[model samples]
Target: MKAKNFLTTGLVLLATFSSVVKAQVAATDPLINQVSHLLIETNKQGLVKAKYASAETRLADLIKAGRSDEARKQMSDLISKIASDLATGQVKADDLKNRSIVTAKKLQKAQLEAVNQYVNGTLSAQDLVNTLKPLNSHYTALVSVLQRYQDVLRSGQSTAAPAQLATIKAGVTDKSSILYARFRLDLLGYSNDTTKDTLTDDLTQAITDFQKNEKLTADGVLGSGSWKVLNQDFAGQISQLRISIDRSRWLPDNLGATHVFVNLARQQLQLYVNSELSMDFKTINGKLERKTPILFDSMTHFILNPTWTVPQNILLEDKVPMFTTNPQKVLDLRMKVIDDLTDKEVDPFSVDWSKVTENNIPYTLVQKPGKGNALGFIKFPLTNPYSIYLHDTDSRNLFAKNDRMLSSGCVRLEKPFEFAEKVTQSMNMMNWSADTLKDATENLSPEAETSTRVKLVKSIPVYLFYLTADVNEKGQVILSNDNYGIDATTYDIISQK
Candidate 1:
């Protein structure tokens, strides 16, 4: 019966992908018409070179000659090329179907073999479940990704008319941008009705919802930031989805029983315990110019009341200018400049402010460990060449903002103490609880300026990845804001494939 069930499930999963592709292909004539129209519309918007760069000169010449029949034939040929490319994808899907069936049979056969070990009272139930959990997780992730891919393909077939929206705020009445905003918001599932184009209260709320999801400032105004995201047409969205799917495949099949996954695109961190979500933390990542690198490492340790050593870039660009203008800022923050050669603290008041330059900086600026410390109270260091880590921040007000990409390179946690407690419990650090950890710092003297570093018994795996698209808990596909424009860069390379 289990074997039969496995066969049924496999068939259903494959059918879902196969049916969607087949249905789209079945209306080949309409599909061609749709493609032709899309090409023309995109060309008008100077986007012809995106996918049809090779055919651009020829198509242009044909259009110039007013050869309607030949132009249609040329477009038909292009469509055929696209169809041929997609057919290759179908072949790959068919190959996956075969492999899945074989794997399912092998799994069923292996289970039957394991039944004998169970009958002999050798294989325990918990052990069996543990063995199967990774496989189950792998299968679930695969199916979820496949579903998202199919949904994206289907959505592309129903591209809304291209509408360009200009910057506008609330109470803006009867403008083309307003109309476009309404339709675009409605299409994105943030709004329901597009019949009303004016910036009504309903439209304002919808824009606000869209802004929040996109990680933009939720001011409920259709400004440049909002328009930038809403302007991603069907082709651009499809390209993004393709890139996301390819990147998703790069992740390990099993991300361990316990791990930390950071999505740089969403600026969020997820902690999974026993392969189940334990906690979700809002994070403030790096700025657009200073991007947080995508990497994989293990969190080896965390510090309590961590002292912040200002990086060279920060010193040169931010602090030096501030200190040059107003030296009092350094004294207020309890910042000290240490001579790099002598390893001794230098008085900020002794240095000539106007003479200091980035190239001639001879001292390292370090902030003392206290309430005013930049690295707040805790710091989780990861083993990476980028020198980026997850840590607490003194700027708590930044968390309240909808758009929280305000860091230099490191990630700032919203709930650092809670995260520390979870990490402590996970490592089973000898009798250490959140309260005990708090107590360690609670009694610190004002003159004390040392950080306590607790090395983990077992390092927790950490993955810093960028994914612009994700499958939500409810099985719905959602898009994240591409703050770093990494998606566009990645799509350029993957589109060739």
Candidate 2:
């Protein structure tokens, strides 16, 4: 009986020993070691694991507590910092920790202020909730991207290719890219319902919309060019815009309560009244060579029966040849040859066109404004040596083109009539109605038959700005194309200061 009991005890001890071995093997598995290594590296890199989850929870709590601005500011700062770090280098763990602490304190202060403001009826509960929604959404996205990036950096044995890294960075801030993504999600909350195929259709629609807006050939493929633009660093662009804004600080602050604002980069115009956008429209900018100047000035007067005094350069280069080849061409085009001999308009057909030389052209070519005239129907006269005035163009079709650099040096406004009307109305001008304007235009003749001047009763200010970035009402920054290639030159000038 004693021998049998001892044998049983030995067998039980063997079973226990085998269980310990299996547990040890499982702990030391290669996959387990790799995962452990990833977590450690991620922590060391100052990447917070479960960042999305944490951020979402925090945002929810903030919203519930009615701290919208605080949440927004925090998320904005956080994303900005992450973008900066990605562009530069990894942020120090200590710095991040310190920043997080500082942010917490700020949030607390903001929360108290918000609560007080709410109690005082400064902000309604619904307003507070509405404001918080964007902040919460932004934070959620930010956290998601950051965590995904961290995971890519950690789990993936290989580092992301330079191109991939660049793409990721650009996607974070590019409005076009974000809008495209949002469109793909149909602005509907992301769902797990794949079998319904709604996501695919949504993505297709998103691509089409993006292509249409960008003025690209609307093939549904999201090509590299589109992707590159989508991934551009908007924070950098905003910084650049800030630099431009500072450069334009030399301009007068009070451009009047009503004025026109043009952002060259975005190729847009906004007519503002008392600091609100009364009207907005698309615009084409100067081409590469004949780029628009960045300056501020006011329109003093509108010349309805205006005359286009041919530019000296055009006269010297273009007219000289044309006059020599066929003087009748100038005559037919309604250009009066101002004879240097008499300082008066000479009949182009009667001139001895063969004798005219480059140095002694002996006359100025002036085109009296009329139907099919260069200045169209109106000209907004301003003081500038470049002869760059805001003027209507007979070639209205040029405005429809993507590259609107056809002008010699003048600004061709898309809606010049409406624009002029707005300015005139703002100035409290007399008899400046559409009827009066129509009468003046119809009666416009080369004889200067009437004093067709829509003189401003009060002069309104005009600012020719070059803003590359502008924050919309929704707080999203809008970027524009650098048509003039002035971004680099402007950036250099700004950096020096």
Candidate 3:
């Protein structure tokens, strides 16, 4: 009787210990259940429908069946779609619902794997918590940042001015201020000794660098102009870059091994060889009165001695009056008057000056190409409706100026000869040397009655883009001048879409 009671007591104690161990496991392993409860709450808020819930359940079951890799891939694809919808401003309640379901499925899978790994002695409990904590914090921060920007955009505020900074105090915090300061420091590559309070020198140097890059006045003060640029939300800028990258996905993957790329907003041209930048130069864009068109094509031919057929607007407004008012002025400027009906050059003494009216003339005036010609020595030809091309300019001094938007519509290159040489060599073609260019200019005479044609051995690609910001080869972000006033328009269009 005593042996039987002892055995029974031992069995009862064993049963009680097993129950306690199971309870401990259940209490500690709540990650999967926590994620599952979150999904259920999101669904109650009308975030997910029946079909998505069913799919997510199936995905979770598959993960339990040890198909975690496939489940994770599916979840990643769904997350990417959700991100895209958010970027395009098309996020519906249903989209969020579906996202929650997918996220729940992924979280469940991750938790199961984590628990199993811990049981197998591959991961400690502390390690699991540490791994998840940072990820959760980062996601929360990202969502908060995105929501803040979205609210600001939706408010339909006008341009952010210095006076408006006080009004936005409700939306900003010390954390945000610190983040912006850190970002500015990173952009300028400040030393480790730089601190928040004594950041005057760093800020001054950064402002100077920003001004130089944007081609603005290089004063090292955070005035209205500089503050306007620096105050932009860094997250918004990153989002804009992402949108641009997506838009560029429709473009041809390979432009060429070598080509010329022009960014209209920056007013710069870059030469790329084998996906690497070989050289770059500043360029003069079209004047405000005449805007440059976005275009993509190949340069078919080039002209060594190019004639500038005086455009009708210029001829009617400026040239005709100067010739009529002062015949000496026309002669001094190397212009000769020609008869309307005869198609022959006329002497200054022969023209009936008083009879020249808008209705009477049937003449076409042409300017011969020379050193003093409007188009200096070379012209690169392409097909476009605007009659625009890249050409050499007689006013080389203008290139030295930071802002060079003096052209009618065509692009004026700083170093035309060098650019032409590089482009021609890239295309396996030959171009005239500096001596040849000079000779061609000097050889233009009255006796040569017709324009000469210069053909290239090969064609080179040309891409005209408008980018206010870009990443350089060294992964540095370059902010350029928005001379055309397109930033606001672009931002609106992107946000709306």
Q: Which number leads on lDDT?
A: 1
Off by over 4 Å in 1: 1-236, 442-445, 495-497
- State how far residue 61 of model 2 sits from its true place (Å): 49
TM-score for all models, in order of appearance: 0.60, 0.55, 0.55
Q: All models: lDDT?
A: 0.61, 0.49, 0.51
Model 1, 1-497: lDDT tens digits are 00112211322333443344334332432333344433332221112123444453464456556675675576556543333222122112123321111111112345444434433346553443333222323224434444443454445544454455467684565476777677566545555456766667888887787776666788988787678777665445544444455355344556778898888887888888777788887899888767777666789889988888898898888888899888888889989889888999878888776776766878888898867788887889988766689998889899887668899989999978778888778767655566776666534676664788888888898877777765444333357767776655544442342
* CA lDDT for candidate 1: 0.61
Off by over 4 Å in 3: 1-182, 185-211, 216-228, 233-251, 327-329, 336-342, 347-361, 428-454, 490-497
**Candidate 3 lDDT over residue span 1-497, tens digit each:** 00112211222333443343334332544333333333332221212112233334554555556565665554444333322222222222122221111111123355446545543446654544333221211122333333333344446633233334221122233443433544553443322232453334555566576666656677764455765666564444544333233223222335676777877767788888666687789888777666665556677777776777666556666677877787676566566555667878877656655566676665556666666667777878776655678888888889888777787767888877777666666656654665555555545564553445666666668776555555444433455555665443434333331
lDDT of 3: 0.51
Candidate 3 weakest ten by summed lDDT: 97-106
Candidate 2 vs candidate 3: which has greater lDDT?
3
Superposition TM-score, candidate 3 onto the true structure: 0.55
What's model 1's lDDT at 419? 81
Better of 1 and 3 by lDDT: 1
